[model samples]
Target: MNKDDAELARFNALARDFWDPKGPMKPLHMLNPLRIDWIENQYGSLVDAEVLDIGCGGGLAAEAMAARGAVVTGLDGADKLLKAAQLHADDHQIQVDYQLGMAEDWAAANPGRYELVTCLEMLEHVPDPESVIAAISHALAPGGTAVLSTLNRTARGFLLGIVAAEYLLKWVEPGTHTYRKFIKPSELAEMCRRHGLEIKAVTGVRLNPLRALQPQPFELTQNDLAVNYFMSVRKPL
Candidate 1:
């Protein structure tokens, strides 16, 4: 499999409790609203937009986008995660097309298909993130937008994003991330530009230390890209 077995195993194990607010995926639950807000602000309203979510994972962002009236299709490599996503969506009566597949395949099969593409907290998991970036670019229609998020490769990113969150605080599975695969903003920007996607904005996701243990500790900001950050890009018409 081109996918990371360890990371996929960890996510598959969480399928049962994926939607639990206080479960292992709490960080995602907490960050989804902020992610949605930033995406909406960057791409404007998602109503009727043909949106594709790469590495959607248990439908966290996909379901949220569907709720906002987007015609959403979520793609992930994990079967259990996709099943969980579908069940959750069915339970909530939220319509979303959750498929177990690779972004590269989807992009190749349907070129210039989606108006918006979202791939959050996923770039660092794959061996060839550049390929994924190219796939994202290819999947977008002209004048479409793509919003992506990932951890920066830096000392602070390693300390807080990996050590603190995974080991010390036990916020997520210890092997959930690999430091070497983490992408720096410059690298990601270069990838986007090389794939012919124009960068619109790169925003940081800041966490207040004092409220680190709280349910909602993250907020988007113009500065502080030492850790997690989001980039919005557009395809030229």
Candidate 2:
């Protein structure tokens, strides 16, 4: 199989475990609340908004958005993951339209449609990030907001996200990430600018254990130290 097919197969294998609260993705489970807060605060309100979750693995983020009263559509390229997302949504009785297709391709088919577009933790995995950014820009309605979260390309990011998170803690599957694919904040901001989206807010993600411990935070202030950066951009009105 080719590289894309191989990657899809690997992700499909992990689809079932992605939403298990007590499974290997404890970190994702723990950070879900925080991510929801971030997304909500950045985008203002999702109530009655038409939202799109690109690469909505297991429909976690989409479900969260739906809980906030948004009409959500979860899109993923992997068939197994999309099926899992659909099943999860069905079991929860939350309505989310899960579609199987590449983000760029899907966006191209339905342009200027969504009020809020979220492409979290997925851009770096694509072969052409610029094209993906352009697609996201096209998919957003005038004055719409798009939030993207991805790893930064730096020594700190590589050491933390890949070396520590993936290799040391075994948080994610081995070979799930590649340092070379990581993108820096400036690169992402510039891409947004080129795609007719203005970068509004850029923040870092912090992970913590639910205990009496200081929060281990990732700061987006310094581009070189930000392991993961969350960006909020908007299409011109």
Candidate 3:
């Protein structure tokens, strides 16, 4: 497995409560709508699109894509998280093909297989993020769009993304992220370019402290890329 075992173990422990709104996965739940909407805006309608979500922990993003009429496949390395995702899908009657595996292997087997590829919040946890980007490039068909989100490697990112989010606010688990693994936007863009993908858009994500009491608190912007951000890329047609 080309994964960090310790990181996988930490996420596995949250499988049981992955879907709870007030639980440790609250940030994901809150940001999901924005993510989905942004994806749709970048790739147009997901209806009938072949979508693959790499590192689809607990299937939050997978289930959402399915609900939007896309044929969704979710790939993850965590067995317990996959089980929780399966159980949740069964309960909701959502048709998401959840698989347990690594993105590189899956990409090798199914090259150019999907119309849209999503690898949100997965890069920072992986052992080699560039390899994952390569896999994403391989799995996407000509003109296909790939969307990714991650924290930037910066002091602001550490202050807000890790310290405030993990320690002060208690928004996510304490060890949810490591500052060193966070990839800067320029580095991410360069990686995507090397993999034959064109950058379409970039957006910064920020949580509104005033909306802390609300179900959704995060917003996407064009100005700030110092911390958490999203990038959209497309394979050449």
lDDT by residue (6-33, candidate 2, tens digit) is 6678788978897886566555666677
Q: How far does residue 19 in candidate 1 sit from its true spot (Å)?
A: 0.8
Which tens-of-lDDT digit does each residue in 152-185 have in candidate 3? 9999999998998899989898989999999999
Model 1 clashing residue pairs (backbone): none
Model 3 — TM-score against the truth? 0.98
Best lDDT goes to which candidate?
A: 3
State residue 114's C-alpha deviation in candidate 3, in Å.
0.5
TM-score of 2: 0.90
TM-score, each model?
Answer: 0.98, 0.90, 0.98
Who is ahead in lDDT, 1 or 3? 3
Cα deviation of 158 in candidate 3 (Å)?
0.4
| Model 3: per-residue Cα lDDT at residue 29 | 92
Tell me model 1's lDDT, rounded to 2 decimals: 0.93
Over all chains combined, what TM-score does candidate 1 have? 0.98
